[model samples]
Target: MSQSDELAAQDAGDSGDGPIEELAELQVKEEARLEKLFAEQREERGLDDETTLHTFFKLFDMWIQLYRLNKCMEVLPEVVPICRSRGGDFHVKGVQALAFTLWKKSQFNDAVKLFHEIEDLIGCSAALCENMGHTYSSMGNFDKASEYFKRALQCLDKEEELGKKTGDRAGILLGLGLIEDRLGRFEQALASVRESQALFRQRANGKPSSLVAKAGMSIAKILLKLALQEPDDDKRQEMEDEAIIREEENVALFEVTCGEDSPLTASALRGLGEAQKRRGRVPEAIASFARSYQIEAQKDAFDLLGIMEVHNHLFGAHMDLVKLGNPLNRASFRNYLPTVDLALDRVRSMKQDANAGAYYKVAGEFAAFAEEYQRASKLLSEAVCLFKTEDDSKVEGLISHCEELKDFCDAQLSAVRGSATANVSESKS
Candidate 1:
């Protein structure tokens, strides 16, 4: 309705492109007007009162719900100082918002510093400590992250005694589970994840749809990881069976709460596929993978990285069937070739990791099976480079296997070279 805003809109309408700048300008004006209104209201109502403090907290929470990170970031810097100036219950949330913004921005060190400073000023809170835990975890400071997460759990327990919400306790457990899993502490990860799953189930209060499903998925994932590390066949099968049961629960819950087409259902299906594969139900595993891939393709097919993962799973399923001498249509995986190539190209552009090496090796092996020896040799060479970055004893077997496979591929090419040379020599003579 403002003159400048109307003019900007009119100019944007004249062009075919949408009015990004005009929309942003209008947003800024709206924010300014709201700020002025809130200031006026604060003047009449008094900022020191509980009601006004409640209003700011709600405002910040609304910003979070809307995912207005830039706006939230802008307001947080000013809001924290104002809260510190007056000092109230709002400071707790102000610190949370500021620290969360810093964490989201990937300014991990600054976020940690700000959280500690806020703790010194207004004392530590569960949410603030949780933010620091997440921040340090993301920054790869696992020890510090573990320390803060445990502290968060303790504070949350004390807060629960005051009749506050304990939903955050489940979140802390989930975080601990993830960290433990990454650290290769499978038992600890299972304990934490299982505890979180139990907590979520207990708190289900008629509408635990997402909460229960999430916790179940976490447990299922941990079980799968444990199964991967287990050398005993029977124990691994048992682990996989447990994981399948968990994933089936998640899938059923998602089917009721969401739909069959939901991404949660797709995720559950993918996990189910892996579990079934490990449990020696290859046919069921292949079916589950195909279903998962179909759902993912329909919903988010253009998500390159995600598609690559799905393709990898699908390819593995097919390869597993092939190994068992089952009649599987190998042509079904031909479509994945281009996607694998794309993933290889993209991964090559980034810093090498074990995951990158695995992808490369699998793609190379797939190519070799298809008798695309030149492509296989090229991809396998890239895989060799990435694998060299890993020195963990666990990966030595994988590295050796890769070298052996690469040599096989080279020999096949060499035989082709010899045959071609013989033909050329005969023709020249």
Candidate 2:
């Protein structure tokens, strides 16, 4: 068989024999070699500890391929000390990898600190500055992020003048555009994002790309903000229509670039859904969010937080559908309530205690909106309990809101029960 056919056959097999298995076997052998290296006398074997340590550290990629990121990071501290002891480019490269790993793990502050250390060691490059920008942006320090993005752009400009390939130019502009948009610089944001989109499309050479799609989304979002600020109704409508079209195109691009069921596609769908929702396309929005939820739910590492956000969006869309006062929409709305409940319960089961109370509170409000008073009461009670135990003062406003919702639910339940009792008495008479 050809190599491709053999690989396909191995993938289709259920015998637990494949490239992954081969990688696993390799990892075991390499681990054994590392153990032997550690146990042997380096002087007698004429082996260098620095080289051995660096080689062992590079096994991080192997561990990552095996989906053992946490384990890889756990062992990083030990390897870091040896690299630092040796110093120079070797240590800088190792630290850079560790910093990126920390960023992937959502440890943004630590990643920023390491990126700074790299800068002190070898100065800043376009890649390092872009990474710093992303780290700061993730931490919600948009001003700092903008600074780094601008610095990265400057470095890329210098590289361009020297006839060097400035590959990350588009990404830096996109990041800067997003920061500017957040800071309410709509015109500047649009200019930067349009430039980024052009560069990305040039790089893609007419092929679909996630970066191109993302830049399109940024432009669409800016248009949305401008639409909100527009005083003329016709101009506002024109802007809104253009935004929706671009959003739809972005969704299509993401579907082609990253498979329909991929998380990236799912996220793009959510963005499209929000635009549709704003345009009063409630049903379309609901469909978009439902698809996103399905993709997130099916992932191996369940995105509980993503699922939670999807639930929030779905609940809001369904409620909007009910507001239309159509008999069919209203009838179908109750059916969605149980699905939301089940999904939120699944998230609650994940023990996201840090945000569990907030989740329950939001769920309770949605339940109350749907007139499911009893369910709302139960959820709000849970919220109160969870929040009370964990910094009640911090969530005083939330607690107050929950209490108000619970009281409203109680009154509605009482009225419902009383009306039922009166009806039964009348029947008996």
Candidate 3:
């Protein structure tokens, strides 16, 4: 063979008759391996690449998990891009998840922005509108929340024709119930939740869904709020009884569906704890609250609130014991005061309208009696302002007490001045 031909043959042999085919094959293999790793990670975290209910739920779960883990930035980029690429059901779900994550992180403005984006994209869905309402409500924007809740109910009404096909009537009803509760429409809330419960019963042959437990909890919470709003002892007792029944139902449902360790189970247990506290069953309430708090720490806001409430109840129980001249209870009262104060601080920070006024009132009274006069005055002012805005008849006694305290302080000041002047006159004589 000629030298040039031999050289060409050698080149061909070196290249395998092409330009680095093996290198290209190796690059493809590497890409596949990386892709596999990505898929595995996604699956491990309960996320999917497609746009289906399962995928949406997986994404929701992942979003919640990431949010709880404080890994928002890590998951936000990956999910947002996928949502933008696949604009449909997945987009709506992504937006909802993003909004919830933002809300959880206390990014209210960003959460509102994502909520609006979802509303624009999907026109109106009951779930989206309800969630937006909840976000607004949490931010203390009740007017806007009410507006969104109305829109959600409208959406549900419009889609009523497709109820059989969608199989989400109960969900829509529950969403409406939540909105009603937020808006302080307790009767309406109860009606909606009861309707949802009935629908679930019909569909599941009297078996409650996990969703029903949530609805029951909502109803129970609303009932408790209503009881708080009532002045008449009999009426309050009736409402409390109703709340207890609803809470019991929620606990039973959670026990049946979620086992002991599930978050819902913890929540239901907490609801029972709250009911017990209101009924003055201190020991039972403490046990339930402790169990719920143990299931989840400060991760769940509700759980945190429950723990705080339990501490407050314990403080009250100890105070009662002290009043009965129990030395042990007096020691416990002193030891728990700081813990109670911490819990109250957390509850104040949450700024839930339902509890804010009460917390402020309690803090004001505690401060005044504890000789923290300046703090007492500020907290009392806050309580008065919130109670005025609340428009509940039940706060009349509290308002009256605050006014009496203000007047008494002024009188005491004048008396002190008079006494000081008399002492000066005596010294001069």
In the range 1-429, model 2's lDDT, one tens digit per residue, is: 000000111111111222222224455565557546544534343323665654454455444333344666666776676667779866875686677566655667887899899889978677677778877877889889888888887888887889974338777777777778778899998999899889878967776655677788777778888988999999988877887788788778766644566555566677778778877888888888877776665543345577678878987887776678744343444555665665675666677563787778877876777778899999899888888877766988888889998999999999999999999999999
Q: Pick the candidate with the highest lDDT.
A: 2
Better of 1 and 3 by lDDT: 1
User: At residue 371, what lDDT does model 1 achieve?
Assistant: 70
lDDT of 1 by residue, 1-429 (tens): 000000111111212233222123333454456566666767888665556655555454434322355767765676777677666546655665666555544566876787787778767666656666666776778898799888888888898999874227766776687678779898998898788768767766554244467668778888888888889998988888889998888778766654576555677888788888887787788788777766655442123355457667877878788898877565555554564565566666656777677777787877877777778878777777777777858677777877888889899999999999999999999
Q: List pairs with backbone clashes in candidate 3.
A: none
**Residue by residue across 335-420, what tens digits does model 3's lDDT show?**
33354465556666776563576666665555555544565666667777777776658778787787666556456556778999
* Alpha-carbon runs more than 4 Å astray in model 3: 1-74, 86-90, 103-108, 162-185, 226-238, 255-266, 296-307, 321-429
29, model 3: CA deviation in Å?
A: 32
Candidate that would win on TM-score: 2
Give the count of colliding residue pairs in each prediction.
0, 0, 0
Worst 10 residues of 2 by lDDT: 1-10
After the best TM-score superposition of candidate 2, give how far the Cα of residue 156 lies from its true spot, in angstroms. Answer: 2.0
Q: Ranking under lDDT, best-scoring first?
A: 2, 1, 3
Full-model lDDT for every candidate: 0.66, 0.69, 0.59
